[model samples]
Target: PASTQRHVKSINKRASGQAFEVILKPLSPVSDAAHSLPSPPKRDISLDDIQKKLEAAEERRRSQEAQVLRALAEKREHERDVLMKAMEENSNFSKMAEEKLQLKMDQIKENRDAHLAAMIERLPNFHGPSTSLHPTPSFSPALTLSRADTRPWRPRGGGPHRHITPPHTIMLTTAISIISGYKHG
Candidate 1:
């Protein structure tokens, strides 16, 4: 009965310890050691042939890189040319606008002078206004300063009214009352 108890205690100790056994074995696909070596290449292939193919591939890759760089440079150059052209056009347009304004001012002066001269000629005793306001047929320092007709506009250089003026200017009106001696109601 003691022997039977001892056998039960041994079985319990083994179950708690949990020891395991292992067995090494080769794979079924590679059972033969001789089959593991790789096969040799045919006699027709050589190191020179492989080297030539590698060099050709390298040359092709270099040519592709060069083409990409050339395309990028061309794109940059085209953009620069477009920007320069736009700036030139803007400068020309501004110059033309300034010339137009000067021409308009000169035209106004001409019309006012012609009208005033005609009205004053009709009167026997017509006194002219101050030289600063209007210029007469005679030459004066004030007339010379305001005169634009004598100095013609040159596109290359030496343009009339080079300075900027107000877009809206006050123009004098012809006063018929001064010439006719008539009173306003």
Candidate 2:
């Protein structure tokens, strides 16, 4: 051991005079231990450790993919629900509009009927001799048409074709025309 240990010489200088100094120092213990000790055995990586890490990474990837799929499904569901709600609202609006139109149409029909009845009730007020021009015409009015004196005629140069429509016929025609015109209008 003594032979294996290494030594070095040292020198010193004084201001008074230059002196020769003999000193022997052995090698430091840290240097000897560095050479004597073997490096720690290299850590061995097992196949199971690498496989476990890969499996964990794959699991994490699958989990992330699942989350993305779930989010997409939820988004589609929300969109579908919104579309259905809009459609329902549109349907309700259409129904309400149709009902309102129908109600207005019914009111118009009632008003037309009332006006027609009022016109029909006023027919008897027309002036006619023995032909009152009532809603229910009497046979006397028809007889008045054929009578010699009541026969309608317009003297045109005293010709044979001087016969014209009777007063009662004219009144009846006016009433009919009024009814037909009201209906059409």
Candidate 3:
């Protein structure tokens, strides 16, 4: 029985690197059991041999394309994960800051309310009419108004419609001052 074989020819370059025509012709197959020859035996390069080589090159090209696409998809997924993690961290920070601000505001309100209550309770005991008329054993600036602070000034309305209540003795000084300035500076 005989066997058919396919072969490819390698191009040889001249030592001078000159271009030459390659004329292709049909070649006969050599028997494997023959005596050693000085030169390599040539074999036929048929349609099947060409098709097999082209198919091998195409296969390599397709495999490389698939590998590149897979790598790109993995990179995109990693970027999305990193972005989501950063957004989550920012959201947590904002929530913590808002809670801290709310706590500070509540503390301020409570302190203000407590201070106001204490001031209201102490007002009457400290502001009697006698406190204004007589000097204490020690000079206390807080309980007494200076002569400048006691000076009279025009009330809010400045005209006929000023807030005058009644003939009460407590308001006699205020009524006289308002009437004195009704028609002049």
Sequence-dependent TM-score of model 3 = 0.46
Number of clashes recorded per candidate: 0, 0, 0
Q: What are the per-residue Cα lDDT tens digits for candidate 3 across 1-185?
A: 12344444556778999756555444445543365567877888999999999999999999999999999999999999999999999999999999999999999979865754454344332332233333342223323334554444434655765444333222333332332343132
Which has the higher TM-score value, candidate number 1 or candidate number 2? 2
Writing each residue's lDDT as its tens digit, candidate 2 over 1-185 gives: 87466554556678877867565656777778888877799988899999999999999999999999999999999999999999999999999999999999999989977875765565544333232343234323453344564656676677677668765567655655666565455
Clashing pairs in 3: none
| Candidates, ranked, TM-score | 2, 3, 1
Question: Model 1, residue 177: what's the lDDT?
Answer: 35
Best by TM-score: 2
lDDT of each: 0.57, 0.69, 0.58
Model 1: weakest 10-residue lDDT segment is 165-174
For candidate 1, lDDT tens digit of each residue in 36-123? 8878876786999999999999999999999999999999999999999999999999999999999999998798668767655653
- Models 1 onward score TM values of 0.39, 0.51, 0.46
Q: Which stretches of candidate 3 lie over 4 Å from their true place?
A: 1-37, 125-185
